[model samples]
Target: MKIYFKTFIAIIFGVSLLGCDPAEKQNKNEEFPILGRKQFVERTVNGETVVDTIDHTIPDFRLVNQDSIWVTPKSFENKVYVADFFFTSCPTICPTMKKEMLRVYNAYKNNNSVAIISHTIDPKHDTVALLKDFAQRLDVEAPKWNFVTGNKEEIYELGQKGYMVTAMEDENEEGGYIHSGAFILVDKEKHVRGVYDGTNSNDVDRLIKDIDRLLATYNEPKTKS
Candidate 1:
């Protein structure tokens, strides 16, 4: 009787563990690194002030979206977003990148918590009206997916420093400007979570999966009572 009781208890325990929420399990199994600078802060540790490095966050920016509305980082507060750099006239990679981006857009088009920001590296030619037209042709609606154009220098700096992507002018390139074909995933806290090649289907698929993982971080997992 004792052996049977012990076996029964063990079986119950194993079943209970398996009954835990799958979402919680998914959250536990996947971990995304928070990329960026870590700062040290003064903290009372063992009655002594100690500093620790913290996660680095993306900074604020003011730029014009497809609607010509001024968009600041505040616009994305509490929102998880993907960002990229492109121009309307790119004869090469931009189309492939945009095609992959469309996959991302379609995945979260109705989800208000998610957004896509595509900044034009060639702001000189990609005016507000031009961007609007381009977005319309691509079936992207603004505020949800913003095709932004702004001061060329600021945009370039944001690409290099803010998102850690490349953006610069190169006359030898097919396009007048050069920029990375990377899609950057940023969390609600404005920290970069992942960067994927926008031109690769597999990478974009991974990006889509990571977005779900990031979103899971914000959602409340069921309690294992």
Candidate 2:
């Protein structure tokens, strides 16, 4: 009787180890999904290539430019751009941010290969007229530099979703909206290559080097082996 009881106890233990409850195993298996794509490069904060996400298609957006021109994703389809998120009314870091961008604008103003997009976080107060005025103050030439404003929700979503930049309204802060001061370097294919501190010349210098490297890569002709 003891031998028979021991055999039955071992069998029960083995089955329990495999699945104490079959229902829980099925629920856990359903939660995991396979990684689908690896289209764009994702680098570490220190600028090392680590893992890349598969979605390479650039996100779509629509807004009116400084010239009151309706601009869409296609406007930048074949060009690289250093993008930043800010509002004209910002009194803290925005002026410094704009100064850094001015250097970049001066650097690439003559080159038709690259562009700049300064998107406003506060679209309600920053109308097309207001954006136009802001562009003029910064000497943002038409077709080269664009100051854009649109539906508030859309622009905010672009910050969090598209650019992976942060822009959120903080009722507790002095200014309603808070945003990062990084300049995002994007390729012609619409993939973000690097992000740099707009306030730091050293970071911007590195960003410039990367941008030049990327442009050269696209322009270079393939040599026959």
Candidate 3:
């Protein structure tokens, strides 16, 4: 189940400003087709194809965690992970997304190998302190699950362009900003193996299965600490 909207007109406007190709945008209300649990290979610069992959490849990104610590792609080297976008003040889909993430956090708390990344769409408003409080309210523990905020432009770029995810803001239309609640599963070798709906429990369960499959098939990609 996907979270709903008060208004999506502003989101559509933002998409238009970005010159979205109608063809590539996701259907009005359809999830992307994802194969269940398969170990596909991901070709990388290291000349090795990390086994068990799906849709996307990792691109270098820089962000800050809830504690305001600098974080980057290198932070998760060799780790299998899940990530989503939301705002602390969001009254619509964000609540459901965060609540769902809490479930994921509880389910995988004992598993250090799995990690969660939450990025705030409204970076200016969602400061470290705010995010910290929000996480506490949700009871998300530290280290394993990290809430992040960074440069607004960079955040939008990473969400929209780099990750091929949807994110935009438009004051003229309806909703101030819009984003997807998809939880992306990235294999250790840096290939995005699966994308699940953080708002949908079923998709998230499948995400867990796929994560286990990726772990079983591909050794973590090595990185410098």
C-alpha positional error of residue 170 in candidate 2 after TM-score superposition, expressed in Å: 0.9
Q: Each model's number of backbone clashes?
A: 0, 3, 4
Error of 1 at 182 (Å): 0.3
User: How big is the RMSD of model 3?
Assistant: 15.4
lDDT of 2 at 3: 98
Could you tell me the lDDT of residue 14 within candidate 1?
Answer: 93
lDDT of 2 by residue, 1-225 (tens): 999999999999998887866777775454312122346667786776687667534479988888999777788878888889998999888889899888888888888888989899888898888888888888778678889888888988887777778888987766788899989887777777777899898888877877777787777778843
lDDT tens digits, residues 1-225, model 1? Answer: 999999999999998888777868886786689887777788898899888877878877999998989988888878899999999999989999999999999999888999999999999899999999999999889889999989999999898988999999999888788889999999988999999999999999999999988888788666744
Please list all clashing residue pairs in model 1, or write none if there are none. Answer: none
- For model 2 the TM-score comes to 0.74
Per-candidate TM-scores read 0.82, 0.74, 0.70
Q: What overall lDDT, based on C-alpha atoms, would model 1 receive against the true structure?
A: 0.91
- Over 4 Å off, model 3: 1-56, 172-175, 219-225
Flag regions of model 1 displaced more than 4 Å: 1-28, 41-47, 221-225
Worst 10 residues of 1 by lDDT: 216-225
Please list all clashing residue pairs in model 2, or write none if there are none: 37-54, 38-54, 39-54
| Weakest ten-residue segment in model 2 by summed lDDT | 28-37
- List lDDT for all candidates, in order: 0.91, 0.81, 0.75
Clashes of 3: 4
Residue 2 local lDDT, model 2: 100
